[model samples]
Target: MMDAHRQNRLRALTTPVVLIAILLIFVLIVTATGDKSLARMAAQTLIRVIFVVGLWIFVGNSGVVSFGHAGFMAIGAYCSAWLTLRPQMKGMFLPDLPPWLASAEWPHLPATVVSGVLAALIALFVGAAILRLSGIAASIATFAFLAIVNTVYSNWEGVTGATSSVVGLDRYADEWVTLAWASVAVFVATLHANSASGLALRATREDEVAAAASGVNMYRHRLLSLVISGFFTGVSGVLLGHSLGVLNPNSFYLGITFITLAMLVVGGIGSLSGAVIGVLVLSVLIEGLVRFERGVDIGGASFALPSGAQEILIGIIMILVLIIRPSGLTGGRELRLPVLGWRVRHSKQEPQSTN
Candidate 1:
């Protein structure tokens, strides 16, 4: 009986099973439909999986709300532009870039990596200062950091193209590439969740005073999670830039920030599977609403939703989910496949050590 229980724990404790299942489902749908528009939507959803999962790495474990990750996304997007754009295009569009950056052109692989690294470095440097705070104060500091980043990027004309879209980015992130990164995000997140740092952070999230008394360095764990989260968020930004063949500071602002958070919370911020499932469910709903707005054919007549109905409808859904399940759909539980008569559940009152 103990061995059977142990096997279930091993199976449910890791994130790869959930991710693989999700991937298989997504691929099956894409294959069956073979629709270009649907494929594009899938790519976008996968990208969101990366974003929400990365955000989960920090926010889920630390219990700290972050409005600053989008800034890291913007930084990553622009960093990709700096590394991957042709020299001539950089001269024309980003004249004020330092001399070396202006001439440097790298392939998508290296550029994507560098973009993530740069964002992680920035997170490391800034998080050392910011992670010292806790609760709402820490959340506010992150928001302030985000505001500062957005303000600077929006106004820096030559380096960031200011408020204008930076065109000529290479379109390299198709559905497959996005899937690869999303898988990486899931794997990394799961690994960290089972690691010492993730557990330490979650301990602090539950009771900071107790955790600190136990010799768990709250600040260090939070900073580490922030850096890891920043890296994956940065990668998502690079994928988005390549998908659109353009970079814009506004794209990484509040709109993306709020929606991602909504997804994370609705799916269960306490579980790794929550991040992936949230993106999948919410993205499908948004895309469906978009299609309805474009008009749907029913018995030879086209019915269309009003222009802004999608937002309103999605907002209602979010509210309903929050009201119905405050802890989210997964309720802090990992993926546990049922075996015969055995049932699996996470006790809500008891916080799991593997966050």
Candidate 2:
């Protein structure tokens, strides 16, 4: 029995160990080669990992799909951009702004935090209106929210530059910043997943009527997840805005929303670790494939994919994953370390059992 328990412990630890080892290898490769470009790519990928993980927080736990996360991200990007861009530039570009917004020039960190707060507030308001819906209704409502936000940002020139790109923000993102934010996001998500509220949310996901019968307020739990997801997604937007040093309303358009949703779906909508791995794998593939030379030879012939091939590839992958592993790679399993004594005893017992 002890040996069986040990084997279980070792099995539990294997996934996490492999993931950590791979992460460390990636870091070492980027650092040792002095590749700033690759490092930047890695940083951006980590930031996005946080954003996808945020999606998992709500959609994974509650089993409610959301397409409005991009709206929260847009809110954060614009808020941070407005706050941190030079005052003089704002005066030129957005002269009709409110006195407080026009007068203040915030540092990057404070601006990022404020952006997150603004997104959270918006999410709270929206959640109150939409969380009462079930299944497809909720999903459609969230998509409508994204459309509304996109329209507003596109037409609201004074605040969002209308259709033009917003420019001239300080660039302050690096690997350390990306990793720190990702770690915080992971910690928060894990805590929430293990919390009482999380349990209630999960119960709601399993059976809303049953959960309600048990006195679990489904709306309240769903709202909580939405707020948390919005907060982290907002932070991700800040990182993205800073990393790019420019922003555009169109950048957060439906294409982006679809791509993100695809990532979550392919990674396993029910699994957080699956979400992270899916983002890592897909992001790398998409970005890396784009760098291939135009005339590369394949099967004795020269060929190159079109500019938008990555998106197509992602869609295909999503379909395949859905068909083949609908539960996701990890199937909602968490990575954990093994107990050494358990594994050693299990190994010894395995030989005796074989004899």
Candidate 3:
């Protein structure tokens, strides 16, 4: 019995453990190559993995598609920048900032935590009202929220650099840094998926009316999921800014919003495994397309795709995937220990036979 309990515990952790192992191996391989470009791509891919996993926390469980997480990312990026930038730099570029923020400079780690919390706070506030409305209405509201954030940041010259890019940030978030965060995101997502709120939210996703009848507080669970989702989404933004050493409002706009969503949908938005795998698969394809656009050498001949062709090709691939496997690459299932699953199946059958 003790052995069985221990096996059950190990089985429960299988998903997150496997996901983190994959990320670790990916980083190790990239490091072994000693190629700067591949390392950079790996870093960016890890960031996207965090973003998609964060998105899955809400969308996967709630079955409500969101278009506003990019805005949360923008908020975190700028907030971390504000906290970490030199006082002189902030004064020069963002003279309009409050006195405390203008003079304050902080380390990246705490700033990351604070930025994530702030993003979660914003999500909590916004979701309180938005989650009240069900279905498409809520989705539209989230989109509107994103647009508002973008417009405000774009025109807020003194604080966010307006239409200009904010530079001179610390570029410390490399592949290893992002890999750690990606692991954390996967672990947190796994916990949430197994939590009561996550289970209830998924129930609501399956049948809203039935869940409500069963006494699941739909609004509460939805809001909780969104808050959790916003935190990691925000942290991913912080990593993106630090990795590139620049912050731009437009960087967190429609392009990232749709691409991340595409990754989640392509991977199987209903499972945490799908979120990570989707990012990996899509990132690799995008990287390959980018290399092709730069021209590949074949037997002293040059082969190159047209500039911007990658986007079109990726779009086509996503469409094909959706057509063929709408449930996503993972089919809404997690990575589990196969033997453990088999044992559970046999156990159920054994009980049936006894009856």
Model 1: per-residue Cα lDDT over 1-355, one tens digit each: 2445565546655457667677768967885798988988888888899999999999999999999999899889999999999999999989999999999999899999999999999999889999988889989999998899899999999999999889998887888899989888888988898788988999999999999899999989999999999999999999999988988888999999999999999999988888788888899999999999999999999999999999999999999998999988888778755542143334223455785
Span of ten consecutive residues with least summed lDDT in model 2: 12-21
Give the local distance difference test score of model 1. 0.88
Global Cα RMSD, each model: 5.2, 4.5, 2.4
Q: Tens-digit lDDT track for model 3 on 1-355?
A: 2355556656777899889988999999989999999999999999999999999999999999999999999999999999999999998889899999999899999999999999999999999989999889999999999999999999999999998999989999999999999999999988888888888999999999999999999999999999999999999999999999999899999999999999999999888999999999999999999999999999999999999999999999999999999999999888877787677556555643463
**Ranking of all candidate structures by their TM-score, best first:** 3, 1, 2
- Name the best candidate (by TM-score): 3
- Model 2 C-alpha lDDT per residue in residues 1-355, reported as the tens digit of each score: 4556556545544543544455556656777879888888888888778789888899999998898899999999999988988888787776667878887899888898899999999999999999989899999999999999999988888878878787888888876787778777776887787678998999999998899999999999999999999999989988888888888877777877777777777776776667777778778877767765344677998877787776677678778877888877566666654565456655675645453
User: Higher TM-score: candidate 2 or 3?
Assistant: 3
What would the TM-scores of all predictions be? 0.93, 0.87, 0.95
Clashing pairs in 2: none
Where model 1 places Cα greater than 4 Å from the true spot, the runs are 1-9, 339-355
Top candidate (lDDT): 3
Worst 10 residues of 3 by lDDT: 346-355
